[model samples]
Structures are given as structure tokens and as C-alpha cells.
Target: MKKLLHFLFHSEVPDINERYRKVTSAFVVIFIIGYSIGFLQLLHLGPYLGPGLGDNVSFQPLITSLQALHSQNPSLWYALIALLCVTVSFRLLVMLAGYFLFEREEGSAYPIKWIIVFFLCNLFSTLTIPLLLFALATLFWVSGLDFNLGWQWIDHNVRLANQLVVNHVPTLINAPAPIAVLMIAIISGFFHYWFHRLGHTQRILWLLFHRPHHMTPALMQSTTMAVFTALPLFFFIILPYNLIFGACTKLFSSEPLYTEVIIFNCLILIPEIFGHHTALYQIASRNQLIRLASFISGGGVYHYMHHSSEPEHCGRSGAVNLVNIGGGPLFIWDIVFGTYCPLSAKTPRAGLSGQPELHMNPIRLTLAGLAQICNELYRNPSWREKWRIVIGSSSYTPTLSTDFAIKSNKIRQEQATPNPATIKNFTFSAPADAIASVAAKPVTGPQS
Candidate 1:
């Protein structure tokens, strides 16, 4: 017992507790095992305030319509398969190419695990999130708010922009095929730039919806880093782009523009997909043809900077996705907004910083940002301050603690004391010392 105590408390070796490691590993294994079995039926969150709180709130109708939409459209499958070939299958090939082309830098995670993490999280989200949205829409529908019109607002804007282009530059409408595609790209890139920027720059959007994409620890794990993120990234992102763009193209044009579909896909999604892969970006940066095509837009390099873990790359201090906020033709927007960074400026190492918990559990990860918000709200007692925690910046933290004045953070920093809550992880004597130290510390602040 005495030797054990000495080893734990005074041994030069830092990792002295094999039992602790085993315990933690057990927890992790259990977490994964339990969650894996339960994610299908056990993963649901809604039907929230039903029958008693609000009668006849059913998600079945919404769920069924989604199922029908897939079963209903055979063409959707073709489009999906084609998209998968280019994006997902393409990504796997890129990884292999990187393995052969350049020696992977030391410490690069193989990304197989992270890739699986992406797919699993994506599957869970695909099954759950849309239903949640549909249910919310159903509620709004019951409340008599026109949610469909809100989404259609984007379509209306697209039409308005098209009309403006047609009226102002008549030749642009009838331009050669290449020129017409460029126009469509620019217009699409422009609208998407503003919308995409909102996901990153806006407080509510970033914290609740977009931060997980930035939380990815490595991008090379096929650069698909979470678009199951920001439903993270990759297949879901590209598929929708191809699907919606194809549909819209068919809607506008006289015939199917299969060539245009592929072109537009490459242009818009390169940043979202290729940009996240280190080896791919390395290759893309060197290939003049690729460079020339993506020159005017925020391509691989622009997005590489956004996912960079470097403090400056985070753009707004603690927030990320601020640097090189948009892709494709929106490089101009990034520059105008001062969010642009050049690939040549510095070689960026992608993935998240200081947030390993984001990768731990897929289910928790999606709502972790929300959980963090709830934690903050719990800490803050003032309703006004709580409101700010929700609506204000994610980095925002209330400076005050109830009616009492405290200088707790500074005092703890100076004292270098351990938290009482973490005492269970250490020796009994250490915890006693921690308690004494905490008790001895002064709580200084302005008088309330």
C-alpha cells in the first residue's frame, strides 16, 4: 500500500495508474457499445410535448413523406450514385494517392476511424434531424407560420437575381455554354457565400449548428471531416448540391445539362471536399490546371486555413470558420470581409484545437454545443445574462456570479489549485490540500 501511494504521488512516471486507465477505457467501451445498439430506435428526441401538452403531435406523417420522397423518386438514386462516385469514392482514391505521392507527415492520424465516425454520425443525423425539422415545421404549421415560404425565399432570390442578370446583361443570358455556367456559378456562389458565412459567423448558428465541423481533429482522414458537421460534410453536402443544382438546372434549362452539373459540382464543392484533405490540397495547389480553375474562388487552400487549428486562423479569437469563410467565387467576399487568408501565407495544419471531447461520442458531439450552452445558462443566474448566453457570442461568458462579487477565475489561476469536482481523480491528501487552497483563496471583485 505504501509503495503504491509512493508510486502514485511521488513517482517520476506521470502515468502511474493503470487502474484509472482501465476504468476510463471501460466507460468509453460501454458508451460506444450501448450507443451503437440503441442509435436506431433509442436515438429519437421528439414527440416532445404531445397529446397532453399539445394534442395529436405526430412525426409519422413527416417521417413517411421523407421515406416516400426517396421511394418516390427513382432519378434521385441515379443522382445520388453519381454524386457518391465523384465525392465519396473520389475521396477514398485521393487518400490512396496521397499515401503514394507524398510521405505522410508524422503524427497524421490514418483517418479510418474518423471516417467511420463521420458515416455513423451522418447516419444518425440523417435519420433524426430532418424528422426534428419536419416536426418543428409541423408545429409552426399548427401555429399558422408559413415555414415553406421561408425556404422558398431562397428560390425567389435566385429568380430575382436571374431576372436582373437577364435584364441588365442580355448577352449574359444567351452567352456561350461556358459563360452561362460561369454566371450560374457566380450567382450560386454569391448567395451561398452569405448563407454559408452565417453558419460560421453568427453566434447561434456557429454554436448550435456549425462548430462541430471545426471540431474535427484531422482533415486528411479524407477531408470528409464532419460535413456530418457544420450534417457534417462530404457525401451529404455534395449529394444535396448535385441534387438541388441538377433539379434547378432542369427547372431552368430546356434539357439536362449533365456536363454543366459535373462542372458546377467541382467548382462549388472543391472547397468543401478537397480543401479539407491535406494531400489533395498539396496536389491541387501544385497542379496549374486545378489552380487556374479555382483561382478566383476560395478553393482548397482557402478552406484549409479555415480548419487550421492555429489561433489566428480561428479569425474571431475563439471562433473558427471565420478565415476564408466562403468558397468558389466567394473568395472575393472573404477578401472584402477581411476573412480571406492565402495558401502561400502559411502552411496550415487542419483539425480542431482544445476540443477532443467533440470527437468522443457522435450523439453527444452533435448536441455538445447545445449542452455547453445549457451548462452556461445553468451557471448564470440572471435571466438577462442567460438570454445573452443564448443570443450573444458563443465566446461570451457572464462576468458576474449572482449578487455576490467574485474574482474566482483569477484567484484559481494564481493559486494553481485543482477543482473540487475533479478531486475524485486524485489522492485523498491532494484533494484535502486542494480544498484548503480553495478555501484560503480570496474572492475579490467590484462591490455589488
Candidate 2:
């Protein structure tokens, strides 16, 4: 027990930052092609959904009406693309100063096939998220809990107290450009921090939505995979933000809120894109603003620590990796909650260390987390244990050892057994290139 506890929280210093070799021309070519495809899709080649709400209660039409925002009503294409471009470009720019992408994968296009699916899923999530949230809004509306109604009642006459707070604190709707952007960052980041933490803390949530992301060993090609969530988790993550956004539309009756929203959605997500890359690369910068921003936002070294699942990085219970949990324009919440792990010399490995299936196949990996939960449910026959499995901390062990899950995963692995029956049984066949997505695939590409 003492050894187990020590293994869980043993924090030894890690190697200093690694410098990756120059990327091959093929990787550059792949990125160019990918970006071109996205640009074309943005320009109407992509499928567009009709506005979700007929009455425009969610400001659905106003967002879809904007050409820059994409065809889907209130789509996040603008923000999504901005994040991709900025993240990749920022690292590329930092290339003039330091290496970020893995040096071993320079000559490889092997991961592209696996990486593209997540990229496309991210696109899918952004476009469909608004529509999904309004469906949730409709559900909440039926429950006598319309956030807009409550907000409207409070803002009915724009009372003196409300006005003072609006003027002083920058309400989501009425604030000027600079203040409004800051407010959006805080609000959106606040939601992201909690939701992200929730996804980690709860076993059900970790399996259902977060596991697919954590399965990727490399963060470089897969950073955009963040938020590749299913419909249920999609509603969970965006509902509160949408509710607040809807209520804010009521705040400014005269000025157009859509324009500000376009700006808000696009600009406020800088911190969201900022942190994950830090998972793999220790960005070197003496620029005080950049340094300070990373420090406050938990973006640079701090957030990189969040990805570490090594026993050395885990907490005393060995159940959670509680380092640098803040993901925001400010990680002040993490500081307040005592979950912040400052970026130090420890270079933690990303991904599950000893998992059977690292979830290389996007098709299988997407729901694999839920499958693990279900396995746990099956292993624990007792109803009380089952209930605890869903709601309990993710690190909570079941009555049965997870060796069953490990063996089941191994049996299902394409390489392990080459099981066609397994492949055909899944909703989608595992793609051929999944094998190449593994970290062991060499830089010259796969030996196979």
C-alpha cells in the first residue's frame, strides 16, 4: 500500500525540453492540402443545417446569416478554424525559436489518416453544437427554467444596481469591444474549466466523451481533436454557455448582438487552443507578456502537466492526475481550488501508459470509453456498485480487477488477433492507416 501510494504521487524531475528536427516537406504538403480542403468546405462545399429555432430565441438566424461564421446557423467554423490556424501557425512561428512537433514523425504522413478523422469531427461538433444546445434549451424551457426569462425579469427595467454592475463588470451583452472580449474569455473559460474537470473527475464522463482524446499518444497532430464530443456531451458542454448567450441577446435590445457574438466566439477561444499544445512542447519565450499570459492562463508548461497520467504525475490516491486543472483565460480558479500544478522541469508523457487499446482507430475509439464503463458495469454485478461506477470518481476501482477490460481490448485489437468478425461487428470498419498512427511508427513512415 505504501509503495502504491508512493508510485502514484512520485514526482521525479523529468528531462529538459526536447528540440524536434525540421518537419519533412510531406508533412507540410499534408497540412496545405488539409487547410485547402477546410477553406473550400467553409465556402459552401460543406453541408449546412437549417436554423434550429424558428423564433430565433437562440440567435440562430443572426449567426447563420453571417458569411464569415459559416453556413450552419451559429456555427463555430470561424472559431474552430481560427484555433487550428493559430495553434499550428503559432508553433510554426515558435519554430524560428524552438522545436514543437515530434522530430521522429517528420517524414511521415502515416498519422494524417487517423488525425483527419478527429479534425473533421471537431468541425462537425462546431457546426452542430448550436442546434444541439437549443434542443436542450427547449427541454429546459419545458421544465419552467428558461434562463432567458429569468435574465429578462432581472433586466426588465435595467435597474440601477444592474446598470452599475453592467458598467463596472462588463455584462456579456452590453460591454464595449475590449471589455466584452475579456468577459467572454472569462465566462467561456470558466465553463470550459469546470466541464473539462468534470469530464476528468467522473468515470462515466471520462469514458463517454474524454477518453477518445486522451488515447492519442501524440498531441501534435491531434490537438484539434479536442471537443470531438458526441451529441449528449456536446449539449452538456455548450448548454450553459448557450443559455448565457441567449439571455445576453435580451440585454442589448438596440445594438446588434450577433456581430459581437461572432467576435466573441472567435476571439475568446484563444486560451482554449493555447493550453493543449503545451502538453507536448515546452515553448521557450522570454517575452514577458507571453510568459505572464501562460502563467495566468495555465497554457504553457502548467497545462502540459495536466496531460500527464504517469504514476509519478498522479495524486496520492493514484486515481487522478490533478495537476494544472485550470483551462481558461485565467487559471485563478485552479489556484483557488488547489488543483493548479505549475509547469516545472517534469516532462510527462501524454496518453494512457499501459492501456491495451490506445484507440488508434477513430471509429472504435470514439465509443471505447463508454465500452470501458459498460465493462465495469458488467464486472460489478451489484446494483449499488453499478450506481457508484456511473457517479463515482473515475479512479474508483470496481469489485473486479480491470484485467478483464485489458484482455477484452487485446482480443478486439486488429493487430493482436486480426479479427474480421470484430471489425465487421463494429459500426464502422477500422481504417488501414490506424496502425501507422501509433507513436512507434518511424519518421520515414511505417516499416509495414
Candidate 3:
């Protein structure tokens, strides 16, 4: 176990030249896994097991119409694929633009290899892992265990709320599909803001999951996805929003919420991609207008500022200033909560303060982060902690400190400088006894 921890936490940094190959391999592996999951979903090989698993009875007409459209016109599939391709291509182009336009110092600029690695890391952490977890949760549900752990109670309440709205509220039930979709998006975004905020302020969550992203020495476009966290924690991080979305869908509309979700996600991605940009691009004439847009959409310079390693931007524990700018698609939450940091504030240093120059490789870094969480759990035996871990509690004691960094720096500086004080304090003693004094006396005759 010790050896494993050492391997996970103490792996040597890879050479710059080798990083590209390593990163590419990681991407390929995650892509294959993600693709397989998607393929299974499309084939309906996996049972759709959840609260709303077979609740499409009210949307049979819409489902039939979609099925008929698919049966009549195969070209629609091709068109949809083309549209997805175009959207992805545009996002990639924007990332490239940010990379080139940003003026990064030679030392600080991310190498092509590192950028690829970071991008793939983010992809796996954000998309692939969450998808896998959702699938697993569904599988668990099919086996008759409510795999939701901490979320089951919340899910039950949400379902009840949905039932009330759908069966009781005639106006909401009759609302237009677009309005329903918009409401879902806004509600989901609001929850996401809180989830992110809680992740930072909560000690155990931050140490196990959130700290890795902040540990990076520099920020690049790919840094947006570089969340180093336990896989289980990743599942918990995303579960609330998914549950809330499902509830809203069941409550508000008969149409399949999947399409709406895709659209909302794509729209949200626009700001997210730009927010991760290294260069600041002024989007409007007035700063207030820009802030307002960011507040509404949950993107822009404020998000970038959240990544700042400076104490002011982030708390002493390295969490982003929760009092300001921790929203998702809406910054209004931050404003209301009094955590709204403006973009006009001076750009703060990015990454963890006093971060080590030499760090573990990406894969090891991830494993190490998880290992730390397990170790913490083992040390503290409490049902509450276990429940929190299972249900994704966003509270814990803050433990990360600058003491190690300060001590390491002090040692390095001491090693670099000779201890003149010690040398100056050195003194030679002579025996006071006549025989010892004669032996210790200087040989004056010989010197002469």
C-alpha cells in the first residue's frame, strides 16, 4: 500500500517530448470507452432504469412522430450528424484562437503536448466518467438497489414535486415546450452553481476532488477540464443536476428532455470554452453589460478569475472565492450571494500557490488524489462521513496548508546558502590541567 501510494504520488514528471504520445494514448482510451457507452445506449442494449424510465406514455405522439420521421427520412440522421460535426469543429476553432491570441511567456506557455494532455484529461473527467457513472447507476437500479445512495431521498421529493406540478398546476402543465425547456435549463444551471460552490468550501470534497485542478501550475484552454478527482466523487458531483433535470422534464413537458438537454449543454459550452481562454476578449462596450451577460450565462473572465491561485481570488485553502463568481450558466446566483468578483479586477496568479515545480504525471496525479480520499476515510471512521461520501456531501474540514511549501522552500534556501552563523560561533577549547595544557599548547619553538 505504501509503495502504491508512493507510485501514485511520486511518479517522475514525463519529458516534454514524451507528453504528446502519453496524452494522445489517454485520449484514445477514453474515446473508445465513451464511444462504446454511447453505442450501447443507442442500441438500447442497456435497460433505461431510473425514476422516469418508462414515463413516455404522455409523449407517445411525439415519440411516434419522431419514429415516423426516422422511418420516412434516413437523411435526417446524416444531417444531424453533420450538425454535430459542425458544432464540434467550431468549438475547436475557438480553442485554437484562444491559444494563439493569448500572449503567454515562453516559460509559462503550454506546450502542444501538454495542451493535448490537459484537453484529454478534461474530456475524460467531465464527459466520459460521468456518462459511465450514470450508466452504472442505471444498471444498479435495474438490479433492484436504488443506486442513488444519497440522492434517493432527493429524487423522491423531486418526483413528488413533478407530480404536483404536472397533475395540479394546469397553467404550468399547459406551458409551451420551449418555455419548459428554458425553465429546466435555468433551474439546472442554478443547482450547478451551488454544487460548484459547495465543492470548494467543503474540505473533504475539495481535497479529494477539487484540489487537483487548482494544483496545475498554469492555465490553458484545456485546463477547463483538468479536474483531478475520484471517479465516485465525479458521479456525485453531476448527480444532483441530472436528478433535478429529470424531475423538471417529468413536471413540465411531455417531449423527450434529451434533445432539450443537448441544446442547453451546447449553449452553455460556448461561454465555458471562452471562459477558459488564456486571453481576455472584450465582448461588449460596457463592462456592466459584459458582467450582466456573464451573470446570465455563467461564463467569461469571472470564471477565469475563479481559477486564480492568488489568496484574494481563492481562499487560503485554495478554493475559489465562494462569495463571488461561482455560478454555472448564470452569474446572478453569485450576485445574490455577494460572491460576484468583477472581471475588471487585476488578473491573479493562476494555479495553487507555492505549487511544486516537479509534480506527478497526470495519471498518477489523479490516482494520488483518489488515494488521499481513501486514506482520509480510513483514518476517520464515521457513518456520517461515509454517508456524505455516498450522498456527495459538500462539507468537510480544510486540511491543505502552505506549511509544506514553506518548509521545503526554507530547506532549499538553507542548502543553497552556507551557515555562516554556525561557522562564526565555532570555538576551540584547551584543557586547563597542566599536563593537558602542555599537550594542547601551540608548538611555538617549531613554528619559529
What is the lDDT for 404 in model 3?
A: 20
lDDT of candidate 2 over 301-367, digit per residue (tens): 4455566555344332232345556544446555545455434344456655333434233333444
Best by lDDT: 3
TM for every model, in the order presented, reads 0.52, 0.54, 0.57
Error of 3 at 28 (Å): 13
Count clashes in each candidate, considering only residues at least 3 apart in sequence or on different chains: 10, 1, 8
Writing each residue's lDDT as its tens digit, candidate 1 over 227-337 gives 433432222233333333333233233332333443344344433445666555655654554444444544544466667665443323433344556633636555544
> In model 1, what lDDT does residue 75 have?
74
What TM-score should be assigned to candidate 2? 0.54
RMSD of each: 18.0, 16.3, 19.6
Leading candidate by TM-score? 3
Error of 1 at 173 (Å): 5.4
Off by over 4 Å in 2: 1-101, 104-173, 221-224, 235-241, 244-274, 278-280, 285-289, 296-301, 311-320, 353-359, 401-448
